[model samples]
Target: MSMSLSTLGALIDTDHMLRACCNNPKCRHYAKLDLEYLAVKLGRDHSSMRDDLVPKLKCSKCKSKNISLILSAKSTEGLGHT
Candidate 1:
């Protein structure tokens, strides 16, 4: 997939899917993030991946701010399942 015009350089240089995982030892919650939503919501502040996005994330289950990110190619349309 190609990068959407408004999404270029927002979260990443290319079109990709982002997944966030909780870093808490007892609560490892995982979730997929919508790049477009983040781009629109964050605007100019969404420049750097780790510097900007990481600080804004929290685990839905444990509400922990410690999170890790995973980047996957947008072209992998059916890879979410096992």
Candidate 2:
């Protein structure tokens, strides 16, 4: 897939996806959402703005405000490519 014009970045257009993990080490609840999915969920054009998503994010396990962001190697299409 080709990259969108969105500020979320060109990585979103690729097969690989991004992961938002719980910042709290104890909290295991993490949200594995793609930039596209996140954009729709947050009613935005893209997930480039971290501030916009941080307030809305919460650890399902511990409900912590602290969160971490991770870029996954696996894309929506498949792995071992990106």
Candidate 3:
């Protein structure tokens, strides 16, 4: 199912994949984040808020704090199916 950036609880409820994309123009790295893990780690209430997790994200490749959140369909390989 198609979705947008919402609460982590909503994402978990919908079983969508949460991806963090590097905002750096040169380093557009993308990575999948575990929603369940995040919910446990960040707490259900904290992670359930809108855009609350974006400010804490960092690009692994470029080590930049400029990150954006995107929702993709859940997949076995963690990449959205075509």
- What TM-score fits each model? 0.70, 0.56, 0.68
Error of 1 at 27 (Å): 1.0
**Model 3, 16: alpha-carbon shift in Å?**
1.4
**By lDDT, highest first, what's the ranking?**
3, 1, 2
Error of 2 at 21 (Å): 2.0
Q: lDDT, candidate 2, residue 54? A: 69
User: Could you tell me the lDDT of residue 12 within candidate 1?
Assistant: 53
Model 1 Cα lDDT, one tens digit per residue, 1-82 = 6644333254455666788889899988899876767766776445546556788767889999899988777778777698
What TM-score would you give candidate 3 relative to the actual structure? 0.68
Which model scores highest in lDDT?
Answer: 3
Q: Poorest 10 consecutive residues of model 1 by lDDT?
A: 3-12
For model 3, residues 1-82, the per-residue Cα lDDT tens digits are 6754456777787767778888899999988887888888876555643367876667889999888877666645545656
What is the per-residue lDDT of model 2 for residues 3-55, given as tens digits with 9 covering 90 to 100? 56334545455545656788777666777765676656755544454565668
Leading candidate by TM-score: 1
Model 1 regions lying over 4 Å from their true place: 1-13, 79-82
Give the Cα lDDT of each candidate.
0.71, 0.62, 0.73
If both were scored by lDDT, which would come out higher, candidate 1 or candidate 3? 3
Local lDDT at 10 for model 1: 40
